[model samples]
Target chain A: MSTRRLFERETFLAPLLLSPVAVYMVLMVGFPFAMAFVYSFSNVTVGNPDFHMTGFGNFTAVLGDPVFRKSLLNTFIFTFISIGLVLILSNMLSELLTRQFRAKWLIRFLIMMPWTAPIALGTIGYLWFLDSVFSPLDWLLRTWGLLGKPHALLGPMSNMYWLGQPGLAMASVILVHVWRLLPLATMIRIAGMNSIPREIIEAAQVDGAGYYRRLFHIVLPLLLPVISVTVLFSTLFTFTDMTVVWVLTKGGPPDHSTQVLASFAFLKGIQGGDLAQGAAISLFFFPVLAGVAAVVLRIAKKAVVT
Target chain B: MANVQLIGIKKHFGGVKAVDGIDLEIKDGEFLALLGPSGSGKTTLMRLVAGLEEPTGGRIVIDGADVNDLAPRERGIAMVFQSYALYPHKTVFGNISFPLSVEKMPKAEMQKKAEWAAGLLGIGHLLDRMPSQISGGERQRVAIARALVRKPKVLLMDEPLSNLDAKVRHTAREELKLFQREINVTTIYVTHDQAEAMGLGDRIAVMHDGTIRQIGTPEAIYHDPANTFVAGFVGIPPMNFLEREGVVIGFRPEALLPAEAVPAEESMRLRFIVERVEDLGSHRLVYGTIGGTKVIANLFFRTPIAEGEERDFAVSNRDLRRFDLRTGERVRP
Candidate 1:
C-alpha cells in the first residue's frame, strides 16, 4: 500500500475509535456542565423554565449570602485539614506496612476495610459510634476520668454532643474523610516506596544512614511526587464530598457552622428550588478546584525523582 | 584503615544455603576480590561484611571490634553497589555529601569534602547535575565518590564496573585500581568476571556453592589453582579437563603447542586428529579429539594446521594439573 493511504487509514481510524468516548462525554458530563453554566447566569427555578439571562445576578446573590460564604470557608478548612491528616497518617502507615513483619497481609487488609466499605455505610457506622448518648468514645473517655471537672481540658463529664456541636462536628467530618482516604494514599505510597531500587536503600544503610535518616533523606525525598499526587486526589475527594456531612449533620447545629460547599449547594439548588443560585454556588467549586489541581500538579512535576 | 575478619560466617535462606561457613581475614589496606559465577554467594559474602545481611552463625569484626550486632551504618562501612545506586533525586553533590549530611556535618566542611571526593573521581564538574543527567560512568564515579566521602575504614564494591560498557570498563578498572592504591583503604570487591578480579584484586578469593573454594594472590590463583573448580573457572577458554584412568588431567589451551615447535626435554607430547581451526587474529584455536576425548590448543595463526589433519601437540609436564576424578581436588606435586 502507498504510504499516503496508510496514513489516511490511520487518521480516519483514530477519530472513528474516539467518537464513542467523545459522544458519551458530551451526553453525560459536557451537557450538564454547559447547562449549569447557562443556568448560573439565568433566572431559572423549579417549574419555571422560561427565564432571561440575569448576568451574574445569581452569582452576586450566592456570594452575598452568609450561609454560602460560610460553606465556602468550611469547604477549604475541611479539604485542607483532612488532606493534611491523610498525608501524614498514610505515610506513617505505608512506612510501617513496608517493613518486614508477621501477619502483614492481614494488617493491611484490616486497614483497607474503611476505604473498601461503602462511604455512606462507613459514615453511618461512625455516626452511631459517635452517638451523643451511647457513644463508645464518650464511654471510654468517662471511664478513663478524662471527662468532668478534674479533666476540664478533656471536655464535660457528660456525653459530648459529637455531631451536634460545630467544632466537634467539623472535626468528625474531617476525621472521617481522612480515614476514608488513608488507604488509597498509603497504597500509593507503598507502590512509590517499592519502585525505589533496593540497592539505593542498601547503599544508604552502608553509608551510615540510620532508619530516620534513610526515611527523611532517601525515602521521603523520592516519594515527594507520589505524596503530592495523593494530596491532590484526597483534596479533590474531600472538597466535593457531601454524603458524610449530609448524613451526619445536614449542615445543622442551628447556625450552619459545619456547612460545606457541596451540601449547601444541594440544600439551596436541589431542595430549595432555586436552580440558578444553586448552579452559581456549585460553579464556585470550578475555579478553586482548578487552582488547587494546577498547583498540586506543578509541585508533583517538580518533585519527580528521575 | 582497618582489617575485616569474618569467622564461621553462615547465611541460609530457608533451605537454600546462600553463604555457607566462611572464614577469612582481610588485611588492612589490602584489596581483596571475591570472584565467582552467578549464585556463587560472592555478593552474600560482601553483604555480610558490610553488615547488610545478618549471618546465621558468625562474628564480624572490623578494626578489632565485633560488629555483629551493629547496623551497617554503625559498622562504619560504605558500599558502591553493582547498580551504582546513585540517589535518583539528589544532585551529584547531594549524593556524595549524604554520608556527611547524615552525621550533621557543617555545610562548608561537607561541601569541601564532597568536592574533594568528586575531584578525586574526576566528577567535580558534574556535581550540580542529577544522577539521571550523568552518563553510566559518571554515575559510577558519583557512587564511588559517595563511598569515599565518609572515609570509611573499609570500602565494599559489589561489581562496580559490571554496569559500564566494555571500553569504559577497561579505563574505569585501571582508574579504580590507581584510586584504591592512593587511598590505601581496606577494600572488598565482589565480581563474577575473572578478568576483573585478576586485574584489580591483590588477592582473589574464588567461591563456589556458598563456600570459598580458593583464596590466594592473583598470581597464585592463576598459576597454581587450589582445586579443579578454581582451575576451570579462572581462565578464559577455561582449562580443559580430560579423564585418564582414575585421575583428571587439566591444562589450559595456551599451554598446548604443536609438538614440532617444542623441545623434546621441555614438554610432553600428544597426538590428535584436528576437527576445526578458528583463526583469531594473532593466534588460532585448534579443536581436536585425543583418544576420543575433545581438547583445544591455542596456536599461532601462521602455524601449519588444517581440519581433519592428525597433529602432535606438546604440553609441559608442569603445566598439566592432575586431580582425582571423583573428588575434583587438585593433586599437588
Candidate 2:
C-alpha cells in the first residue's frame, strides 16, 4: 500500500477504537459535571421543578451561609488530620512490617483487612459497636475499672462527642478515613522497600549506617515518589468521601457537628431541596482538590527516587 | 593491615549447603582472588568474610579477633559490590564520606579523606556528581573510592570489575592492583574470570562445589591444577580432554606439537582429522579428532592449517594428565 493510503487508513480507524471510551467518559463523568456546573447558576430547586438562570446567586448565598463556612472548615480540618495520620501511621506500620519476623504475612493480612472491608458496612458495624446503651467496649472498660460504669459510650460525657460534636466530630471522621486508607499506603511503602536493590542496602550497612540512619538517609528518600503518590490519592479519596459521615452521623446532632462539605452538599440537594446551592457547594471542592493535586505533582517531580 | 582466617566455615540454606566446611587464610597485604563458576560458593565465602552473611558453623577471624557474630560495620571491613552499589541518591563525595561520617569523624577530616581516596581512584573531579549521573567506569571508580576512604584493614570485593566492558575492566583491574599495592591492605576479591584471577591475585583459590579445589600462586594454580574441575575452569580455551584406555587424558593445547617436530623415538604420535582452524591473531587453534575422540591443539600464528586433512600431533608424557573416567579425579601426572 502507498504511504498516504496507509496513513489515511490508520487515521480513519483511530477514532472508531477511541469512540467507546470517549462516549463512556462523557456519560459517566462529563455529563454530570456539565449538569452540575449549569445547575449551580440556575434557580433549580426540588420544591419548584421549574428552573431559570440566577447567575451566581447560588454561589453567593452558599458562600454567605455560616453552616457552609463551618462545613468548609470542617472539611479542611478532617482532611488535614486524615492525611497526616495516614502518612505517619502507614509509614510506621510499613517500617515494622519490613523487618524480619515469623508469621509476618499473617500480620500484614490482618493489617490490610480494614482497608479491604466494605467501608459503609464497617461504619455501620462501628455504629453498633459504639451504641451508648449497649457498647461492648464500655462494658469491658467499666468491668476493668477503666470506666466508672456501663454508661452510654456515645453520650456527650463519654467523649464520643469527638465523633458527635463539630470540630471533634471532624477529627472522628478523619480517624475513620485514615483507618480506611492506611493499608494501601503501607502496602505501597512495603513494595517500594522491596524494590530497592539489596546491594545498595548492604553497601549502606557496610558504611556503618545503623538501621534508623539507613532508613532516614536511604530508604525514606528512595520511597518519596511512592509516598507522594499514595498521599495524594489518600488525600483526594478522604477529602471527597461522604459515606462515613453520612452513615455514621447523618451529618449531625442539630447539624451543628459533623457537617463536612460533601455531606452538606448531599443534604442541600437530596434532603433539603436546595439543589442549586448544593451544586455550588460541591463545585467549590474542585479548586481545593486541584490545588492539592498540583502540589503533589510538583513534589513528585522533584523527588530524587531511583 | 589484618589477615583473615576462615576456620571450617560452613553455611547452609535449608538442606542445601552453600559453603561447606571451607578453611582458608588470607594474609595481610596480599591480594587473594576466590575463583569459581556459578553456584560454587566463592561469592558466599566472600560475603561470610565481609560479615554480610554469618556462617552456620565454624568461625571467621580478622587479626585474631572472632567476627562471626559482628555486623559488617563492626567488623571494620568495606566491600565494593559487583554492582558498584554506590548510593544513587548521593553525590560521589557523599558516598565516599559515608563510612567516615558514620564513625563521627570531623567533617574536615572526612572531606580530606574522601578527596584523597577520590584522587587515588582518579575520580576527584566527579565527586560532586550523583552516581546515576556518571558513566559506569566513573561509578566503579567512585565505589572504589568509597571503599578505600574507610581504609579498613580488610577490603572485600565481589567481582568488582565484572560489571564493566572489556576495555574498562582491563583498566579498572590495573588501577585496582595499583591501589591495593599502594594501600597495602588485605583484599579478598571474587570472580569467575580466570584472567582476572591470574592478573590480580597474589594467591588464587580455585573453588568448586562449595570447597576449595586448589589454592596456590597464579603460576602454581595454572601449571599444577589440583583436579579436573580446576583444570577445566581456569584457562582461556580450557584444558582439552580425550578418552584413552578407559581413562580420560587431558592436556593443555599449548603442550601439544606437530608430530614432525618431535623426536619419533621418544614422542607419542596421535593422528587426527582436522575439523577446523581458528585463527586468533597471534595463535591458531586446530580442532581435530583422533579415533573419534575430540581433541584440540594450539599452534603458532604462521603455521599452515587446513580443514578436512589428516594431521599428526605429539604429546610429551609429562604434559598428559590421566584421570579416572567415572570419578574425574586425577590418576596420574
Q: Which of the numbered candidates is closest to the native, going by highest DockQ?
A: 1
DockQ each: 0.74, 0.68
Candidate 2's residue-wise lDDT over B189-259, tens digit each?
99999899999999999888899999999988877777788888887788888887898888888877888
TM (chain A) per model: 0.91, 0.88
Question: In model 2, which runs have C-alpha deviations exceeding 4 angstroms?
Answer: A1-8, A38-43, A49-64, A92-105, A149-172, A253-255, B242-249, B260-273, B290-292, B308-312, B322-333
Cα lDDT of model 1 by residue, A122-160, tens digit: 999999988988899888878888775555658765878
TM-scores for chain B, listed for all candidates: 0.98, 0.96
- CAPRI quality band, candidate 2: medium
Q: Deviation in angstroms for A211 in model 2?
A: 2.1
Least accurate stretch of 10 residues (summed lDDT) in model 1 chain B?
B260-269
Compared with the true structure, what per-residue lDDT tens digits does model 1 show for residues B211-325? 9999999989988887889998998778878887688998889888888777889677888789999999999998888889888888878988899999788888878888878
The list of candidate 1 runs beyond 4 A from truth reads: A1-12, A47-50, A140-158, B265-267
* Interface DockQ of candidate 1: 0.74
